[model samples]
Target: MRILHTADWHIGRRLHGFDLTKEQNHAFEQIEQIALDEHVDGIIMAGDLYDRSMPSEAAVAQLNQMLQQLNLVDKVPLYAISGNHDSAIRLSTGTPWFKSTQFYMYTRLEQAFKPVELPDTQLFLLPYFEPFAAQQYFNDDSLQHLEQAIVPIVAKMKTLFDPNKKHLLVAHFFVAGSATTDSETQLKVGGLAAVPAGLLKDFDYVALGHLHGKNALHAKNARYSGSPLKFSLSETKQEKGVFIVDTEPFKITFKPLTPLKNVQQLTEYFETLEDKDFYKDLQLDNYFGITLKDRKPIPNVMARLREIYPNIIALNRADGYETNVEGSGESGKQIRQKDPIELLSDFYKQVAKDDLSPQQIKWAQEALKIAAKRESK
Candidate 1:
């Protein structure tokens, strides 16, 4: 059986306060195309179907439409679960109706342990679990870690799973081998996070989620499909893709899912802009994120860069420019020509057209001094 493994759709997710509905819709189009081209038997969405537990109305409409397009329009069986960002009850609603459409939504662990059986394999769907929830489900208080929580769940599943049939496990959790980027929101508190790969050794193939980068984890049979769209500037250089698992003999392959647009972050020194050849080579129309490094401020850097790169998202200085010096030591280092707090106070004063009071000025100076001390230490 040919199955497409994809996760972390994060529908309704935004980038720098800009809505990503269009990008997400385009991704769905690619997913549909893949289903048709590969003749996939099933599409497994590991988790994090939406960006938040309480998604916007537009997000809900888009999600409903996407599901309809995939399950009804294309007739591909889809199985999905809720992640830390999803409201389990909300995603699990209309469960009975969805089954008729060949879409399985697993949100609660206590529902049932029946495996979704295909001609070639049996899938064991384990949604994102909390420690308390797992403990309650199994009535086992000893389930302290996430890896330990899976022991009972998997043991229960073993009763229903046929040893002769190829076993597939779908989950949403931080696994040991996975590498998380700065953009991924932390899900667990303390060191009680992450399930070990050894916990899933019994399954023939494991499809994972939660991590936003493709190849976040490394296991013989486990993998993360990653987010469909780049959600953060930190992910500007990541290559996103989906996983394809061939279960007749049990093999997995990753297929690249193309995005509508590319995200790039380029840094350039403004002092070197005298060379037209350097600026000519930069094609900024493609969602450019440029950083200008200059000792002297250019009057209209935004306007100037826009002439070449129209879609500039942000512009910032990379130089060691200090705006405040709270708690700075009286070291013999080059004294700042301008008081850092005074600069900040001046900036706010200009914006508000009001001068800082004596108390405010003193507070700012103290804050800057504290910052300086921390830096020196």
Candidate 2:
């Protein structure tokens, strides 16, 4: 069975103040084409079907239309789950009847235990869950953190594994070593905080979500399908796509999806930016993160620049000329300031002489919070 693995649709997502309806629709077109061309057995959507927990009515309508096209029109089996950004109870609607059309959607932790058995594979559709929920499900109060809570779940899932068929664990969580971008919200405490990759070794293929980049985690058996769209400027270079996984031989391949308007970055002086010839032939419609090298602020600089590049998301001053308001001028996240994460990252690079690890970043964030509380007291 060759299934298409995709995740983190973020259906209602917006870039800066621009509605991503056009861009998102274009991405879906490519995905539809891929499904048709490949003649995939099934499509697995890991999680984050919506941009927010309570999605807009239009967003809901759009997703409905997309599902109708993919499952109903194309006649393909879809296996999906709700991520941290989704309301599981809300998404659980119509799930009981979804299986009639071969649409398998799992939201609750309890539902994950039951596998969707196929001819060549068994899929464990695990949705994003809080550590507390896992603790309650297993009746183990001792399972306080994600790493601890998932231990029993892994052990139980392994017991159900059949040597006759290949097993795929479809889940959404911050797998411990996976890199993250600014776009993803940190489910710090209650949710699946950080799951170790070692626990997921028994499965033939671990289809993961949460992180926007597919290459975020590089484990042998596990691979993140990533997001179909670039939600942040940090993901400009990331190749967005769906993974085609074969169960019999156990092979996975990433096929790229081209976005309507890709995220981009431009670093230049104020004078050069105003030059008509310099900006000519460029995809000005693409989301841009611009950096200014000019030492002095130009009058009506943003107002003028907007005429040329209307899709600028972030603007930064490399010269350290601070803006009165961070995100008020022209672009959101304007004149980008070094936050705790970046500051700590720089500090670690200087002191330890190596980039800070994800664990170290967590420690720094916690330490900063403790210090802030102390100062306030």
Candidate 3:
């Protein structure tokens, strides 16, 4: 049986304050088309259906439309589980009717025990769970960490595995030795935790989530299908796609997807960036993190660059030039040349390491004016 493996849709995700709804919708279209074209038997969504636990109304609508088209209309069985980013309670609300539509969604750990048995494969879909949940479920207080909690669970799953059919484990936890990017929220951020890859040798294939790159893990049975779109500038080089796994023939195929607007990084000087020839072949709509090699600061640099590259996410200096700020960057003489608001803005940027919002600047201006009036009195 051939099935499509995918994870980390992050439907409501944004990049540097920009809404990604359009790009996400475009990705959903491609995924739907791919599923129909491949004529796969099943679609495996490991975890992270949305970017946040409380997704927007629009996000909900967007996901519902795509899911209806695939699961209800197309008649492909969808096996999914909730990740760290999803609200399991919300997802499980109307799940009673899901089975009729061939939608098997595993939100709680209790649902994971019963494997979704296909003709040629048995899928064990496990959602993201805390150590405390496992601790209580098994009545084992010794389950302190993620790995410690999962080992016993997997042992129980091994007992339920069918002898005739191939086994596939779908999960959303950090595995040991898996390479991670900034886009993924590290499951082990608290401490030494990741489930050891060697512990999962029983499965024919391990469809993973949480990591946005397909090449994150190096285990023989495991693979991260990765995010459908580039969520971070760090993921510029990552080939975003879905993985197709065949049970009988025992094959894995990666089919790439083209993002509507991809994340990218570029480094160039002031004059080079402005040249039309330099950017002629480049995708202007792609999100960019740029570094300028100019030694001296250019006036209204971001404004000038934005006219050509509309989606520049970040701008930095190659030499780490810190101008219009206090102490290290600018002399007191240069600081004195600036207006009160300019000085306050620069000082705020230096101290806070962020730009002053317009509302904040307005409040500061009023405070400065009040100070001036008091001085006159």
Candidate 4:
């Protein structure tokens, strides 16, 4: 049987205040096409369906539409679980109806032991669980860390896990030796954060998530599908896609998807950045993190760059060119070059990565005036 493994959808996620709804929709379209083209028997989504615990109405609509198209219209079986980013209570709202439609969502710790039996494999669903919660659920006071908490759980699953059939563990957790990106949320605390690779070495296939990089961990047959689209500049170099696995001999291959817009970083001097030929063949419309090596601050540098790179996400100084808060080339100087209003505006544009609204500008001006009056006294 052929199955598709995907995770960290992060639907409705945004980048530096830029709405990513359209890009996410475009990625989902590719996923649907891939599923149809591959003719997979089942799909496994490990976790982090949404970017946050509380998603917007539009985000809800987006997920609902995809579910209808996949599980209902296409009639493909899907096994999903909630990550730390998801609100288990919210995602489990329509559990009964979803199960009938071949969309099995496991969000609670109690549902971890249940297996979604496919024709050739038993897919075990293990959602993200807190150490404290697992300690209470199993009534085992010895559960001090994530691995410690999960050790007994997997031991129990081993009793139910059919050795004769192919076994797949669908879980959201950090495994040892996995590379992480800035976009991923930190779910573990203290020393017991990462689960040992040996813990899941026995499974035929382990589809994991929470780490937003594929091939991130060192294990027997485990893979992280990663986020479909780049969520941070750090992940710009990652090749985001889904994994297709065939059960009999246990084979896995990646199928790439082109995102609607790319996340990238550009490092160059102001003069080089201004030359149109510098990025002639490059796609100029992508979201960018820009760094300038110029030693002195350029007047209206951000404004000038925005005229060309409209989707710029950050304006930063390159190594050895860091400036003081007042935009001075040297440090330890009084921040008096620019007034409070100009400084605030510059800060807003750099951090927000977008132009401030009229209301924001007004607030800044009034607040600066109050500061100026206080200074006069």
The numbered model that scores best in TM-score is: 3
lDDT of 1 by residue, 1-377 (tens): 89999999988887766667888998888888887889998899999999889999999999999989899999999988888788998998898788887799999876437678777688888888788898887788998778888778888888888877898888888887677667654443423377879878888888988888886778888888888888777788788878888987777887787777667787778656446777677554556667767644454667877776677777787784444333343332434465677566655664555888889888888888898999999
Please provide, for model 2 over 1-377, each residue's C-alpha lDDT reduced to its tens digit, 9 standing for 90 to 100. 89899999999988888899888889999998998899999899999999898999989999999998999999999999999889999899999998999999999998889999998788999999888898899998998887888899989888888889889999998888887665544433325578889999889899998888888888988988888988888788799999998876778889999889889889999889889888887888878899999766465667778898988898888786644433234332532465878866754565455998889888988999999999999
Better of 2 and 3 by TM-score: 3
Quote model 4's TM-score.
0.86
**Residues 1-377, model 4: lDDT tens digits:** 88899999988788989999989988888988898999998788888899889999999999889888899999988999998888988888888788887899999887888888776788889998888888888898889988799898788788888867888899998887786555543433422388888888778999998877785765659988888888888788899899998878778989998988899999999899889899787788999899998876576889999888889998898865445643434344444666666666766776566777899889878887898899999
Q: Candidate 4: how many backbone clashes?
A: 0
Q: Rank the candidates by TM-score, best first.
A: 3, 4, 2, 1
Models 1 onward score TM values of 0.81, 0.83, 0.87, 0.86
Task: Locate the minimum summed-lDDT window of 10 residues in model 2.
Answer: 326-335
lDDT (Cα, 0-100) at 66 in candidate 3: 81
Clashing residue pair totals per candidate (backbone < 3 A): 11, 0, 0, 0
Question: What is the lDDT for 354 in model 4?
Answer: 77
- Model 1: CA > 4 A from native: 185-192, 271-283, 303-307, 322-377
For candidate 4, the per-residue lDDT at 152 reads 86
TM-score of 2: 0.83
- Lowest-lDDT window of 10 residues in candidate 4? 183-192
Question: Which candidate would rank higher by TM-score, 3 or 4?
Answer: 3
Error of 2 at 210 (Å): 0.3
Instruction: Give the C-alpha lDDT of model 4.
Output: 0.84
